[model samples]
Target: MSIQLVFLGTGSGKPTPQRNVSSMALFRDGELFLFDCGESTQIQMAKSVLRPGALKAIFLTHFHGDHVNGLPGLVGSQTLNQRHEALDIVGPRGLKRWLKCLRELNILWPGFQVRSHEVTEPGIVFEHPEFHIESVALKHRIETWGYALVERDRPGRFDLEGARALGVPHGPMYGRLQRGEAVTLEDGRTVLPQDVLGPPRAGLKIVYCTDTSPCAGAIELARNADVLVHEATYPGGDERLAHERGHSTAADAARCALEAGAKKLVLTHISQKYVRPDIFLEHARAIFPNTVIAQDFFELEVKRRDD
Candidate 1:
């Protein structure tokens, strides 16, 4: 199974003629996850192939309008469509306050069950059978966070030849053996799982760190990630301004990617000043060769390294 990522919106503070705000989606096995719901994110999703009803959870990186202004609209749309499924949302501290404000403004679905988790410490904020969600605080103007979605390692391929050689009859027992389980044969012979199983394969790791300058927490979360989605809200010439505004420049993102040893770096949260996004890509590629600027509706399939 491959993890698919779609960059819904890639603009910085406001929506420009060529780009929207900060929003992205990860889809796998029919489940969709929204990361950083900026303005018009639902509209962007509506324009895509993803089903809004399939959204399982939302992860907010910060409370900036460019990063979280679309939650109310998204939730309201889901409610109006008669979607009653529970929606889980996780974010840094102060998220509850914003949620309460939205509820007071009558923007949220009163009947829809929405669970919110406020992450204050660096730890596992959410866990699923397929992946583990971890967050770390980042250096920013406000309470911001970077996330890591670590997929679980899959079992090795089944050795049908070894199973047959061991005189193991073909049946449901093969399925059991393939799952790293020992099974007994018709002749009372016990076959170990290692006899027919190869080594477990490593899982995929995806990290997202945006809206912040170079920080150790972001580096730690992004270490060795298969794909690192980071912000490049300014050019390298504005390093001073980038640090002052708590935003990362294209060069800063590249430095982080190089330090973290990320496999691929995707520069998102683009600034409107640069008409051509290739400038950011060029700056980032100076240090991190595997870097690209993100565009709206940008889709990538996160495949296993071995593949």
Candidate 2:
């Protein structure tokens, strides 16, 4: 299955003429996961290919206005649209309290179930059949979390010639073998999956870290990630300001990517001070050659290493 990333809003603190606040959409197979629903996030979704009804979960990094101000409006809109699928909202501590307040204020009266998951500590927060999500505390002024979506390792390709040589008839038994299950033949012969399958293939890992300064947690979460989406709220020369403000410079983001051995680095959460992203790209590419500056509505398809 293919995984796609859509940058809904990439501006920091506030929206700019060219960029919105902080929001990103991750489309895995058919399900959609949103990160940081900043103000006007729904508007950005409307303009992009994302469907509100397809959203499975919203993973927030913090409670900053630029990171979570659009939650109520988005949930309310889902109610208006009559969505029935349960939506999971995962974030740092205080998320459940904030959701409770929204419910009391009638700001989010969703017809579907709204599951809120507050992360008191860093560990696996959400799990699915094919993948799981892990969270880690980041260095920020407020309580914040970085997330990593890791897919489960898949079985290796089935060797049809090997199966045929083993006298294994092709049918349901082929599927069973491909799924790493042993199958019993009508002749009382037992065939293990390893008999006709290659070595297990590695899975994909995507990490998202933002609204934070350079921290060990970020590097740990991003280790060997296929793609690392990190915040670059300042230019290379503004490291002092970026650190003081609990944000990261382009160089800082690149260094984290390099340290984590990330295959690709995408710099987002751009400050409004820079009208252009040339400097940010230049700074990041200096340290991490496989770095790109994210823009509003920027879309990227993360392919497997084998592909």
Candidate 3:
């Protein structure tokens, strides 16, 4: 019923003394989903209530060192920590080979399951009973991708008042009506759920993008997201630098959020040049006022507010 985002690290490739690279953990219900396991990610997860072994899946945007440095360690730690379930890792092509090489050189953690999936096109990457993931190609120096997590819509609450008005007493019958089923009363009268149940509500959507410039695919993948976590490696002042490096600025990220109709924007992958993040946030807020600068150890809770 709640979506929680924990910021493990927010700095870009060149790490500063205080900030590590990009890493984040998303928790919805009881499952934990990870995005970009940069260096020190294991340590970061240790700081939170998230158990590293409980990570249901990991989605890597690219093979950039900063984005994937902690993968081997994370996998290795699962074995060390004694995990029982398999870990699903979904990313761009060559992911399997990369992990294979790492395992050949180092030890392959034996206890947990680690499945590697290489995505070549845009579509669903991973799916479970509760959630699903999809991605789109991003514009970058290397082959990179972004992801969107779509949760399945849950059933709506039952209309207890409507049921009462229909002469349905409060008991086990109410539970059956809540499940969208008809209940037979002791009086031999049938009560339909449609008269007592409200319409099903839509679920929340979370999208993430890293190490990319402005691209149309990125916008489409992030459409109508409750939270869009996009990279703002630089502020808006340096368009040339951003273009040269195939990176996005704060303004670029903000525009993407506005274009995608995202309700909130999380600006991350911060450049080390700026000590104070307010400058980056200020530029982004100029366009997308809902923008917030991602900070280490910061946690954002996603929930719907009454209109």
| Top of the candidates by lDDT | 2
lDDT tens per residue, model 2, 1-307: 6799999999998887799999999999889999899999999999999888789999999989999999899999999998998999999889888889988988777799999999998899999999999999999999999999999998987899999999899789999899889998889999999999988888899999998999999999999999999999997988998899899999999999999999999999998989889999999999999999999999999987653
Candidate 2: TM-score?
0.97
Q: Which stretches of candidate 3 lie over 4 Å from their true place?
A: 169-176, 182-190
Model 2: CA > 4 A from native: none
> Judged by lDDT against the true structure, how good is candidate 3?
0.87
Measured against the true structure, the TM-scores of the candidates, in listed sequence, are: 0.96, 0.97, 0.93
- Please give, for residues 171-290, the per-residue lDDT of candidate 3 as tens digits: 888888877788888899898878787777678899998889999988998899999999999989897899789899999999999999999999999998888998898899999999
- In terms of TM-score, the best-performing candidate is 2
- Global CA lDDT of candidate 1, please? 0.90
Candidate 1 structure quality by residue, lDDT tens digits, 131-187: 889999999999999898998887787889988999999999988988888998879
Q: Is candidate 2 or candidate 3 better by TM-score?
A: 2
